[model samples]
Target: MKKAIGQILSGNMLSKALGLLREILMAKFFGTGDINGAYRIAQTGTLVPINFMTSDSLNSAFIPLYKKYLAEDEQRAAVFKYCMFLFFSVVSILIFSILYFQSEYWVKLMAPGISESAREMSVSLLKVMAVCCPFYLCSGLVNYISMAHGDYKPMSMRASAQNVGMVLGVVAAFYSGNYLYLAWGFTGSYVFFSFWVVFRAFKGEILNFPIRLETKEVKLVMSNFWITLRPLLILPLILQGNITLERALASLISIDVVSALDYARFITDTVVFILSVPIAFAGLSEWASQTPEQVREKIIKIYYWLALLVINMSFFIFLSARDIVIFLFMRGEFNEQSVMATTHIIQGMSIGLWAQVVGYIFIKALSAHLNNRKVLVVMVFSLLSNAIVNVLTYKIWGAFGLGIGNAIYGIVMFLVSAWYLKIARSLYPVIIQISAGIVIYFCVYRFIGGYFNESTSAMLRLLVNGMVFFLFAFLWAMLFPFYRQGVIKVMTRKRLR
Candidate 1:
């Protein structure tokens, strides 16, 4: 189990590193321009449905069901695959048809604050991106087949392929001298990558697309869909509340506000991908397999350490936002103003990193227990809170207001979910660790600011400050009785030669 955890973490880390490099290149080339905003909206529109159908539903439903089928009747696995394929094919066609026909209206609705040129560009990009819907739906089914077989290597490689496609699209944009060609490049990559996964699945004999669906298989699929719908019905309202509000409100801001928010969000998500994905993949399977007492013990043991890591990293990034943005992105059309705007948004978003970690973990833990209804309820309430705050504050605060609302929503969801989990005993230690980490970070930031000019490179300042803060926090944790015991156990476990 530990080895499996290590493999998952390693794959996640590798994928994140590749994604980080891709983002750096993208920021340097595009910044927060009309073109970039159009691309972002197009990509978001393309991915939203895929995320809903596959990630949101498949992870929670398909894996468990597949496992059950394998345990009870292994031969039924083929029937399950064919049923899922048929269902996904029908759904994807319907969704894609609507999106293709409604592209213009969606462009007007999603980013009405942008110029006519930007809106038209967005519509064109959305049309191109829509081509990937069927491909993604098929690929998603292949992902489940591979995962059910206990072979995550193919899934990891396929993920890398998707990133490769993004990199190729950016390269095409850089040299093609036309955005349409770049958009086509993006569309082609998704097609190729999705087909690649399908081919691999077929080669392994783990996937078979049936020409005719079985009645019993169809009923089973419908039952699973209904079970999934119990959560899906409320999920969009709960999950998209903040995002929908952000886009709508940003549309009311300055012309560039929407683009700026997207850029900042891309950066913030990069950080989240780094921290959250590995922890989730490593922890979820382990938690799922553990006894209740064992799970509780493990959660308590790791919660404070994870909290400390998030707080320290958020502080480091917040303090170094300006340099990081300027050094990595202040080139070509991405000028000084773009850097300043993006940096401000990054700093604002950093405030919520700890909350995000807690909320994400809670969601995963809840899902493991198949308590989707409770998760949906919490998400709905969080969405409502986000919508109210974003609508009320966005006019006064601009893009930063959107960031603040996101952070607040995360903290609220974490608190609410923690209550649902009945884990108050774990919260006190986490609160103390976070408080100490924040104090240490702020004190260091002030001292560094006194000696160093603001003109210093953001990345350099962040690196130095991060090292000092981490050292202080490490020493502090080593001295505290509870943390000291954890450190001693970890060291002893490693040193048992």
Candidate 2:
């Protein structure tokens, strides 16, 4: 699992580096206005349901069951994959057809404040992009299959391809003054990446696309899928709802508001992609296969490690929010207002980074056990609380308030899951260690930040400050016996494996 995580994290790093470039190009070409805002709404709106069907719904249910089947009989597992592919493919086709024909309705609903001209443009672009949904569904299944086998390289490579395609599309849009190029670019990326994934699966002998409706494995898979569907669907609905609500609220403020939120989220997601997502992906199967005692032990170790990583990242980002935003986005149409807007939002978002990390750890642990009912209850409570907080605070804090509300949701989720799972006591020690580390780092940052000249390049200043901070953090972690022992244990365990 550690090896898989290392590979996935490396790929994630490359993908995020490219993703940053993609966002930079977007800001340069489209600016943080109606054009970009409309595109953002249309893009997010179109993908939300598809994500629900693929990642949140299908993959969540499919992976554990598939792992169980694979353990029993390879042939039976192959048959199950075939049935799932057929089922998902047909559903994806239907979804795409409906979305393509109803593109205008979704666009209008998702971005009501956009100009008529921009809305029409977004609808057209959305329809074109809708062509890629079935392909995404297919590719997503392939990626999930690879994940079940502990190979995340394919998924990471596909994301890199998508980022590369978007960068090319943004360049085309820049030269041609045609935003449609961006949609086509993304479609091309999905189509190509899907083909590549299938080719890789074939080489690995993991491609089993034949339909075998008569097989008992088919009946078994279908039954399990339906059983897993209900509780699994809650997470996606809440996640999609959060995005829609955030965008809706931002639109009420201004198009720039939506763009600002998007920019800030991109920064926070970079941290999540690196530190949290890889572990969740790699550990799902591992946890599922573990004994109850082993799962408890694993969760404790994993949670503290994630807490350390996320806290360091959160503090670094919070301290360097302005420099990061200016260095990455203060160009072309992304002006002073855009920089200030994005910087504030990033700081707000950073406050929740630790909570997000902890929340994800709890989510994966629960899912591993297929304890979906308890997880569902926790998710529902978190979503309701989050919505109320967002409504009450958005007026005063704007996008930053949205971040705070989300952070609060993450905290609630982690605490609730910990208490329910009877793991709350295990967190007390790590909490103290993390708190002390944070205070020490903050003081050092205050003294260190004063030394950098204001006239220096933002990127240079950030790079230098990041180096200094990491050095201090490294020393702090190494000096602590608990952290030192944890690091050695991971290294020793990996070597033994």
Candidate 3:
């Protein structure tokens, strides 16, 4: 799991590094305007559903089954790979056609509250964005398939390629003054990636596609896929649908609301997802063969370690959100209002970042158990509560209410997954530790922040405050047995080397 995480982390780091650059370029070029809002919708609107079908929950279903099929019979596994690839390609291409032809209606469904002109822009962008659905679907398959085969490096580098596409679009749109390139550049990334991923998968000998297989062999693969995929299919519907609605909800306020909310999410979501996602992916692969009890125990241990780092991270983001926003995005059309808009949302969302780290693992644990039904039940509850919470609060807080809703959703997701897994009881101690850590970190941050004067630069204050706070957190965290041991082992290893 550690090795897998390292592989995932390295790729994610570069990818996210580029992602930051991409967001910076976007902020400078477009800011919180209708053009940016529509572009965001065009990109997010198309990709969200595509992600639902092909990413997260789908990968959970695919990787374990791929491993099982390969172990039991390599030939059958290859057949399954080809079968799934063919199946998704056909399905996704059909989806692309429908979305391409119906982008006008599609944009309306995605963000009904946008102005008529924004809607028109979204339609145009969605048409171009629609072209990448099949590529994303197919590329996701090869990436996961490659991961199953112990090839993680190419997968990590993939983000750079994809971001390179978006970055190009940003520069082109800035120089050429044609926003159409935004959609075009974004779509081109996935098209490039589909070819890149498949080639890597083939070169790694992960699977030899287009190989001869009997009708019976295809049936066997499909049968297993059906069994594996059916249980987890609705996950995307519940989870992804909730996200779409949330974005739509943002759109309802204003195009600027939609854009600001999108901007806010990019920062908060990256912080959470980048940290948790690799661990979840790697943990799923490891826990796939473990018993329920063993998996539960590992969940507790992972939570124990991961919670501290993430909680500190969340609080840091919360404390310095305004500064961070200003540092990252306070230029060009992104002005003080943009800073305030995104800063509030980032702070609101930070309240729940720690929850997602654990929640992701819990979901993966359930998926590893093939207990997708339970996963569905928890998500449904979380979605309902998330909706109700957002409804009641959006009036008060505007789109930033959605950020609070996000925190609630993640906390609910984590708690519910824990309850369903029968590990809720064991997690009590871990939760208490995390709570205490947050309280202490906040107090310390407040104390330390008092020393930094208004004369300091936002970036400089953020840097100094963060480093000092973490140094204190590190010293305080050493009082705990687990953390102390972890630190000692690290120091010992360094001395030996």
Preferred candidate (TM-score higher): 1 or 3: 3
- Candidate 2 local distance difference test against the native: 0.80
Q: What count of clashes does model 1 give?
A: 1
How well is each residue in 245-336 modelled by candidate 3, as lDDT tens digits? 88788888767677788778888768765788777878777888899889888888778788778887888888888888888888888877
For model 2, the stretches where C-alpha displacement exceeds 4 angstroms are: 209-212, 215-217, 440-449, 452-454, 475-479, 484-497
- Candidate 3: segments with Cα more than 4 A from true spot: 209-212, 440-449, 453-455
> Per-residue lDDT for 427 in model 3?
75
Q: Ten residues in a row with the worst lDDT in model 3?
A: 442-451
404: Cα error in model 2, Å: 1.7
| Residue 453 in candidate 2, Cα distance off native in Å | 6.1
Residues 82-183 of candidate 2: C-alpha lDDT, one tens digit per residue: 877888799888879877998888877776666787778788788878889988889999998998887788967877898998899889977998888888
TM-score of 1: 0.91
Clashes of each: 1, 0, 0
> Which pairs clash (backbone N, Cα, C closer than 3 Å) in model 3?
none
